[model samples]
Target: MRIIIVDDEMLARGVMREYLAAHADVEIVAECANGFEAVKAITELEPDLVFLDMQMPKLDGFEVAELAGGKTRFIFATAFDQYALKAFEVHALDYLLKPFSQQRLDQALAHARASLAAGSGQRDAEAAAVSAAARDVAATRVRPAERVLIRDGARVHVIPAEKIEYVEAQDDYVQIHSDGKAYLKNQRMAELEEQLDADKFIRIHRSYLVNIECVARIEQAGKDSHQAVLHDGTRLAISRSGYQRIRAVMQ
Candidate 1:
């Protein structure tokens, strides 16, 4: 079996490598220290399995998985327990928490081997089903993010939430508009909506999430639909339901 290990920490990678060296059936094809490298390596190597770390600079494991799709099987090894729910939602082959023992690693590898032998058909089916459900309701209610991360080529941007004018859904990603510029971030609109302070941001349409402070006026487009004019003159479609929701922010 061919495998690739992806993690930001050299120590973590070395430990995993040391443990895997004893396995006769597996060949270590490549190692990546970040999501960008992981994406490139996985695309080129197309290894049978990947050991993915959830938290890394730039793109996280979920974003990498989003970019890679479900072509390669994955076993998550990360220190974070927060992603446990999201990891299972994607129907990953297995998850390994940090500080794992050789025995635990062996158990996860055994599961990966069995899944490989059975074929990827079932995994693909469950992945598609879960992925669809996950995006529809991705995050939970709590403290909203004060700053959001965006990756544009080699440049990583950290935009403050207060400066954001609005967000629009684009395919699987969202375009965050702020300060006369736009940045595309790989995240679900529903998930993002839940993360932003409820009093500051409101969903004005199924495709649009607007910062309440940026809304300049509400224009009646027709009897059934309306438009939300931002301070910069950017007009956004407002659904009937959106019009009602706008009342909270308008006050």
Candidate 2:
């Protein structure tokens, strides 16, 4: 299996390479010094596995995984245990604490190989469970968004969901475009759809879901897609399947 080692420290990367070299089935494709480099390498090389480091200069491992979009199985090699819970939350295959033993590294490799063989089935199951649990939590959790919560740096600004014109998917995040500015949230389009009021927001495409209240016009695009022009003049394409659903609601 092709693998990439991502660590800010040169020594960590070297150590991982040495440990992985003992495995005949594993081949080191490249080594990255930071999360941004890791992201670029993963996108271009499309390695089967990644030896990810938790902390890096610019992006960090969590951001890297999010950017990768589950394309590669991640085996986190970190000195810190604090990120273990968050790593699993992202469905990481394994976590190898720093100063790891060859035996421990081997175990992580075994788990990663098994997970790769299962493809995305295990991930899908985990996602389903998470979704179900999130539903339960949402039921009990206080509704913080009478409007919306705009995550600006370390602080969160709550705005009304009704004011949201539309949302666009960017990698693992969704850009919540409202009145004049856009807010970035760590969420998927599908997840946001479930949380938002279905009556007010409608998914117009795989990458976009818009507030029906903010839709100014629907223009024909092609045989299998249509463009929705929002009140803010943002043009979003609607897939044939999504267009049908939107049309059904309108009718």
Candidate 3:
């Protein structure tokens, strides 16, 4: 079996590599320091499994998994207790909590090995179970995003979530407008909508997310159309439902 270890800290990667050295059947294909490298390696190497860290530079573990974890099984290794709960929700093979004992690592590897050999029917059943569990905790786990991370070339931009005036969908990505400047992010608008604080950001249209506090005035554009005017004089299209949402909140 081929494996990769992805963690930002070299020491952490070394610890994982040293622990895995005992498994004779597995070959360590690569060790990555960031999610970007992990994504590239996953695409090129296509390892059988990866030991992914939940927190890393650039993209977080969940984002990387969304972009590249489809073809390979992953056991997330993280110190975050919150992610331990989320790991099961995301259908991870298993998670190795930080400072994991040798026994714990062996158990996780055993689980991964067994699952990898299981039939498609078993995988489908497990996926269904995880999906149901995810639904059960989705409501309770709606933590508002405090900062939005955007990568532009070699530059990493961190935008305060509350500073966002609005978000416009641009193909597969989204354009976030804030304080007279716009930033591009490689993310779906629907995903951002769910992560942003609901009380602050609202889906004013299928293609737009508006910061409720930034609204100067909402005007009827025509019989069936409406527009939201921001503090900086930016006007955004609003759907009927969007207008109703604003009305219900601001009334």
Alpha carbon lDDT of each predicted model: 0.86, 0.79, 0.85
lDDT of 3 by residue, 82-178 (tens): 7776776657899888989878998999998998889677788888998787667665765787888775654556689988989999988999987
What TM-score does each of the candidates earn? 0.76, 0.58, 0.77
Question: Candidate 3: where is the Cα deviation over 4 Å?
Answer: 119-121, 148-160, 168-191, 231-234, 248-251
Q: Give me the candidate number with maximum lDDT.
A: 1
Candidate 1 segments whose C-alpha is farther than 4 A from its true place: 80-82, 128-164, 169-197, 221-225
lDDT of 2 by residue, 75-131 (tens): 899999977766754567788888999999999899888877886787688677755
Worst 10 residues of 3 by lDDT: 149-158
Q: Model 2, residue 231: displacement in angstroms?
A: 17
- Candidate 3: the clashing residue pairs are none
